[model samples]
Target: MEFLQLKYFQTAARYEHITKAAEELRIAQPSLSKTIARLEEDLGVQLFDRQGRNIQLNACGRAFLEHVNRAFMELDNGIKKVKDLAGMKKVSISIAMTLPKILPKLLSPFLNQYPHVHFRQIMEPPSILKRKLEDGEIDLCISPVPFGSPAIEWKPLFTDDIYLIVPTDHYLAGRKSIHISEIKNESFILMNTGFSIRDLVDKLFNEAGFTPEIIMEVNDPETIIGMIRRGKGVTFISKRDWQYVSHLIPEKIRINDPNWHQMIGLSWSTKKDLSIEAYHFKQYVIEFFEKT
Candidate 1:
């Protein structure tokens, strides 16, 4: 019934452990348990199924938690709106992306125009980025692939062709284009697994019917380019990424496959209300891509 009771119940449901939730809430365990008990009594339904020391949210608990989450989200949105109306708080936007390098290009101009606005950025894989959107933890997500969730809305910003890149002096560098099968035996330097690009390239490899002889698995794109420049190995990179490595001038050959392109886009949860500042940034991102 009380706001504190609902807050305590939300935290308990998240952890499924009274002790852990109480620890996080910085309250005594007994007090937290009593609060939950009172809440259940008022609601006239058992929310959690209890074991000795652990608890699980029952069907009723899960159903109620959905409404509780929406209630908290709306309260947070109301606070943000009031702060915006009063000009009492500096606007901040939280963004998560799969591609870290593109953020500067997207944010620099916008930040220059609105110097007082603050930005919090994070780099996460596509799956985690999707979850962050649904949980309202991030205002927007820039991803190479669509999250494909009914609760999330995605818009394609641009598509870039994927290309095979190798050292200038490599044997196949003279060719303008090549099939993936032709390079099946060649050593590759690839982005590590879990990266969206890595997953895309892996699918291409699978379609080509052979596993690439990977000489290195790297996390940084610049490092992968550095290795390629030294003739260490070859790799696949999107066309837009060429701007970062153009000076090095590694040989970029087109892949003959029809599916060798990636669509990068922005996504946000349909369930959460966007703050005025966050909404502006989202529009800025869309226009930024349009002009490019």
Candidate 2:
């Protein structure tokens, strides 16, 4: 099979629409289709299921797409490595994170050391970040916890306490700390379901034996903090996040539950080739936490 055939098949699999994929690749729809057909024939498996004009990845296609993505990613990494070795290094590291606000502080030391380094940051939920890391779309991810993938290598950073935040005028605001069971009936403005903190909050509520009365689910931490300042609802905040806007929300009550804290860490692909820049950044992160 030709390399172009694999590339065409991957583009089609990504869009799952032959015409749209062709448009994106700047190729004719029929040519793209024939290329994919030839690839399927060579592989002896149907990559997609066609429903008239629409198409979807079949089981085999999904499996094949995984390998194709990694193959392209490795090829890209190889080119970058050669460029770095030739002293034409202009490294760009792609990163996805749940707590993006913390990244500036975390990366400052590394950036100070390597002024030539650049980053592409994607602030996404933990689930999506994990998927991107697994798919080799991003070089690394910073999240509360590691995903259970053999291809992923998780290095523990540091743990932080989770606070039950409320407005100063709220009824529970006077208390030094509160139990998870205490907040069962209160309205909550939490992060949306994809976040690691959201998962933790849901699990805490489940253990407390009642579902929270969620008023709104937000993606941004600043929005959640804003709502809390206006006495809208209560939500959990990591110690790191709370530090940034502590003056805005003074009622940072600790969660009395022992397991209420989160362990944030760096996760990278064990299978993908790590560029020199990514390798240095990973080491810097691990050592930074150690010094702290």
- How much does candidate 1 score in TM-score? 0.69
**lDDT by residue for model 2 (105-161), tens:** 888878877767789998887677777888888998878878988989898788988
Residue 286, candidate 1: how far off, in angstroms?
1.1
Q: Report the C-alpha lDDT of model 1 over 56-141, residue by residue, as the tens digit.
A: 99999999999999999999988877777455777888998766667788899987766667889977777778888889998998
Summed over model 1, clashes come to: 0
| Angstrom error at residue 36, model 1 | 40
- Residue 246's lDDT within candidate 2 is 85
Global lDDT scores for all candidate models: 0.87, 0.85
Top-scoring candidate (lDDT):
1
Candidate 1: 10-residue stretch with minimal lDDT: 80-89
Report the C-alpha displacement of residue 203, candidate 1, in angstroms.
1.0
